[model samples]
Target: MERITERYRLAVRALGKFHELASRDTLNEIERDALIQRFEFSFELIWKCAKELLYVQDGIDAASPKKVIRACRETGLLSDAETEQALKMVDDRNLTTYTYDEAFVASLIGSFPEYDAVMHSWLEKLK
Candidate 1:
């Protein structure tokens, strides 16, 4: 339980930083890359937080991001629509690993607002 709480706190803090970067009106290449990195960090922490919370709160033991997300929906931490968006967020996070296409980067960054909103809502429910 303590571990779950700690993870949730960390996820919230990291998401706050991600939200700060995502809210910026304009970013150069370096800043854009930094935002993506922050997204990666925030995404990781949040999903893992969900995993831990599920285990501690609901006796669910999801082992992957997608699984954790689906479990979150089952636990009422996420709605069906938010779960779908989160799955897309997972795909975007994975894409950040190997792709450097500028167009894709722009599209991903443009998605930050939605991502940020859903993530925030999910975290709120986790508490």
Candidate 2:
């Protein structure tokens, strides 16, 4: 549906911004925080888009990020490995609330590149 398509496009664009920030060689504390925030929003948009597409295209009505991601795997939108990674990504997204913890931020930011790659691949399938 047009709504799903529009949401997919928006999620893709947000992921693009996340990819840009995540690809940085070094970010100051502020930039690192920005990256974390970007990841949070990007993850949110991507999962919601997935939820919408699953509902419209596949008759699934996943109510949360993890559910949407799991449904994605069951529906062949994600491989088992990708599903595992995405589930971990969801954890990372949840942990973003702890951005004040320097160690946690560093660890989470390190995972962004992989998240970006997986998200891009999944978005392509949605497209």
Candidate 3:
């Protein structure tokens, strides 16, 4: 079984990579596509970390993304704005996985900075 600490470290690493790509000033189609992919990965890691932390530290077994995010918000780990954004990201996660729409992809790419900021905040809190 993976320890929560180990899971957190992996989450942090994914978030860091997302930040690394986010800091870049320019990206062509492929790079932007890559960024979206990284966003999906980091997003998954973050919520999983949140779920694990809540389970191990708070005895709150939130099993789904919505449950975990809502619990985190209730515990003050996530803000209203962040909770809202996290929900949106969760929706996008599904879209990114099974569906491919340029508009959906573009919208998510455009939201990268905000998304990155939200994830960055969680990273700091986890640290």
Candidate 4:
């Protein structure tokens, strides 16, 4: 529970940074990469928050990613499409972290706005 709270705080901080970066007009590749990484990390924290909420409220098992995400949808913490996108971002983030390929990173950078929209909407729900 403490960990979940810490994660939520961290995610909120990361989202603040994301907003700061987004406000800038121009970013170099490295800057964009940093922002993308932070964005991905924030999404992971959102997932954790949803899972912890479900676990606390419904006593659902949170060990399995699939189960946690399903519980999130069932509990109205996330929509079906949002859960799917978050899972995809998790997978893509893993690949980007391990592979270090420019093309894929570019693709990820291009997709950042969509992810940001999803995250912002989720955050709004929290508010």
Candidate 5:
């Protein structure tokens, strides 16, 4: 069994958590914080799995999250909008590493649905 399958499985579990959190009308600071963390980890798995699959199948070497997403898009595994949204997720993940500001964190909450959509699409494609 390929590691990509396991990676995708973990990402999907994170995806479920993200969706559960997103569906809430309100989250306390702690829940919101956890949601942010889940998004970060999920996207990490998402891109790295994509990178692994690309390397295995096409000998494509995308060493970074952004590059792997673009490679996935170029190979037709993802659409342009999904690719662009994925890039923003990467940017958001980077932003989360350095801040605990509520306002900044709140802004990123909107990214969950978009991230979820694209990630689920990628999982289906991989399946």
Candidate 6:
């Protein structure tokens, strides 16, 4: 498989693992932290795959979140609203990694379900 295809597969697998974690109703603090970390990691993986696909398909080099999301829109992979969401997600990803704020992490955790659903839908369409 091509690198982009491999990345997509990895992203899908990560998302699947995140889904498994989220489906459980009872989780300890450590489990919850792990789940959130998985969710964030999967989101980044999905975005990386999406950007790679765009690069392979259109010769577009998306170096920033806005550019990456714009590439997705230009390639018809995401609607305007989804692009907006993706941009926000990217920003949240950066913040989650760089900042030491619990509230930001909590907000990102809350967004995981939508992120997973959007990524899964896009992957299905791509396949």
Best candidate (score: lDDT): 1
How many clashes in candidate 1? 0
Q: Which residues of candidate 2, in runs, are more than 4 Å off?
A: none
Which tens-of-lDDT digit does each residue in 1-127 have in candidate 3?
2676787788888888888888788888888778878998999998988888888778999899999989989988999999998888899887888887888777877788888999888766765
- The worst-scoring run of ten residues by lDDT in candidate 5 lies at 1-10
Per-prediction backbone clash count: 0, 0, 0, 0, 0, 0
Q: Which candidate is the best by TM-score?
A: 1
Question: Who is ahead in TM-score, 2 or 6?
Answer: 2
Candidate 1 local lDDT, residue 61? 84
Q: Candidate 1 lDDT, tens digit per residue, 17-80? A: 9999999999998899999999999999999988988887789988999999999999789999
- List pairs with backbone clashes in candidate 6: none
- List the RMSD of every prediction in angstroms: 0.8, 1.1, 1.7, 2.4, 1.3, 1.9
What is the descending lDDT order? Answer: 1, 2, 3, 5, 6, 4
Q: Could you tell me the C-alpha RMSD of candidate 2 in Å?
A: 1.1
TM-score of each: 0.97, 0.95, 0.91, 0.80, 0.92, 0.85
Model 6 lDDT per residue over 46-114, tens place:
778877777777888888757877788888888887777777777877776788577876677678777
Cα lDDT, all candidates: 0.93, 0.87, 0.85, 0.72, 0.83, 0.77
Better of 1 and 3 by lDDT: 1
* Model 2 vs. true fold: TM: 0.95
Candidate with better TM-score, 3 vs 4: 3
- The digit string of per-residue lDDT tens for model 5 on 20-60 reads 88778898988988888888877888788888899888899
Candidate 2 per-residue lDDT over residues 35-125, each given as its tens digit: 8888888888888889999998889999999999999999999999889989999988877775468688778877888889899888887
